[model samples]
Target: MKENVFYGKGMGPIKRDFPDIYEAIVELNDAVYTGKVIDYKTQKFIALAIAASNSDDRAVKKQIQSAINEFNATKDEIMDVLRIVLLTSGMPPFVKAVKILYEVME
Candidate 1:
């Protein structure tokens, strides 16, 4: 399987210490990201919005980076996603996500 951007700093230890669980998670991720109907880029944007709505700064940054690196997503595209976040999740998460987005862009 390709490297998963969702695997953060602890993944190496998890992969070494719990191979079965690691593989299960990777397989699940692959299955979910199949792009059968919704394209991967759109899926990623949805994921980004979810992360932002949850006020997860690290996840927001990671999603933004992954979208840009994997799909060449632009600031405008990210801003559009944040606009949805702002509407649905309110200002705190939206502001936090925007801050993380700018940091990632920089």
Candidate 2:
């Protein structure tokens, strides 16, 4: 199954709405692919942290589950990422993201 919240459609609206931000993201992707600054596992952890920090429930759940499934990360590892997000980004978003992870994992 192709698990995309946008249902496999491209993020055209986002790109159109936030051209500069979207361009930066695209550039970052290119740099990551070219420079290899971070490994896949570390990138996955960072993604989970960012998603949790932003309180993007869908992204948090999806990335957490994907990391567990793809990288064999344990619940402890997920919690560790959340903990870091909580420290840096505060508690409300972390709480919200953790609730989603709990529901999905349960």
Candidate 3:
């Protein structure tokens, strides 16, 4: 899949380079899947918001695009959550995320 492109390219090396960190990420993914904190779609949105708020462009774009592809989330819905992220996290993060999203779409 398009998302796998990054990992398949060269990111796998970095992931494997840090076994402990990679394991923690794997554990977190498992918890997120198994935990009942929210429904799958909502969880995806929350994760997208957090990534966007952290100004992690690659992560933000990946999660947002994944949600769109997997859950059929509309652009407006994604933007709404992004707006909330901006409110909670601040302008800088929001702006960075928006720029990344725009770049990805283009």
User: Which one wins on TM-score?
Assistant: 1
Stretches of candidate 1 above 4 Å error? 1-3
Model 1: colliding residue pairs: none
User: Which pairs of residues clash in candidate 3, taking residues 3 or more apart in a chain or in different chains?
Assistant: none
Q: Is candidate 1 or candidate 3 better by TM-score?
A: 1
TM-score of 3: 0.70
Better of 2 and 3 by TM-score: 3
Question: For model 2, what is the error of residue 14's alpha carbon versus the real structure, in angstroms, after optimal superposition?
Answer: 11
Please, what are the lDDT tens digits per residue for candidate 3 over residues 1-106?
1222232244476587976866676666676565366677887788889888888877888887787787877777888888998899999998888787676566
Cα lDDT tens digits, model 1, 1-106, are: 1236553778888899999989998899999988889888899999999999999888888889888988889999999999999999999999999999888888
For model 2, what is the alpha-carbon lDDT of residue 36? 62
| lDDT at position 13, candidate 2 | 75
lDDT of 1: 0.89
Tell me the alpha-carbon RMSD of every candidate: 1.7, 5.2, 4.1
lDDT of 2 by residue, 1-106 (tens): 2122221135677688978876876776655534266667887788789888888877787788888787888878888988998899998988997787788778
Model 2 Cα shift for residue 90 (angstroms): 0.8
Q: Rank the candidates by TM-score, best first.
A: 1, 3, 2
